[model samples]
Target: MKTLLLAESHPPTLEHLTGLLSQAGYTVRAVSDAVMALEHFSADNPDVVVLGVDLPRVDGQHVVHLIRGHSQG
Candidate 1:
């Protein structure tokens, strides 16, 4: 199964998106913040990642930068 790391700060949107991705056959690992997102990114090494721009503490772009810094990806 394909794995997806979903970083969504809003609960309703998170649930809805998770459901949609799950229905489409993705094994989703949902997180509410950039910190958790990065942690999961390292631990899970998911094939896909969906991050919310309005995430708390840190934004999605920075998270992407951090992820890229951690790998050639």
Candidate 2:
């Protein structure tokens, strides 16, 4: 099974996407803010990541940089 990390700001969108992805056989970890997204990214190390640029707390762009930094060191 593949793991997916989903970071979305909108509650409805997050739920809808999560449901769809789950049904498609992915192990999904859905979050609404960048902090939690980063936390999950570190802990889960998912195979795929779906991020919303308008995410709260830290935003998606910053989170991407952080994730990359973590991956490197």
Candidate 3:
């Protein structure tokens, strides 16, 4: 599946998740913040989004809601 990964600022965790997702045959676009994630979302139209709860500006729940809204539309 195509996946959008809203990456954690913590390097190791992001790297590990990226490796696992890649291994599972997911095409991932990693973004470090909600703004970037949202920007990428419009263009990428990923099948799923994996968001970090501790993200800056916007949190994971917010991201989830945004994705769900997009899905509904």
| Top TM-score model | 1
For each candidate, the alpha-carbon lDDT, in order, equals 0.96, 0.95, 0.79
Q: Show model 1 residue runs off by greater than 4 Å.
A: none
Which of candidates 1 and 2 is the stronger one according to TM-score?
1
Per-residue lDDT of candidate 1, residues 2-42 (tens digit)? 99999999999999999999999999999999999999999
Give every collision pair in model 3.
none
Clashes of 3: 0
* CA deviation > 4 Å runs, candidate 3: 4-6
Candidate 2 deviant stretches above 4 angstroms: none
Ranking by TM-score: 1, 2, 3
Candidate number with the higher TM-score (2 or 3) = 2
Whole-model lDDT, model 1? 0.96
By the lDDT metric, which is better: model 2 or model 3? 2
Could you tell me which residue pairs clash in candidate 1?
Answer: none
What's the distance in Å from true for residue 66, model 2?
0.6
Instruction: Please give, for residues 1-73, the per-residue lDDT of candidate 2 as tens digits.
Output: 9999999999999999999999999999999999999999989999998999999888899999999899999
Return the TM-score for candidate 2, rounded to 2 decimals. Answer: 0.94
Worst 10 residues of 3 by lDDT: 1-10
RMSD of 3: 1.7
Better of 1 and 3 by TM-score: 1
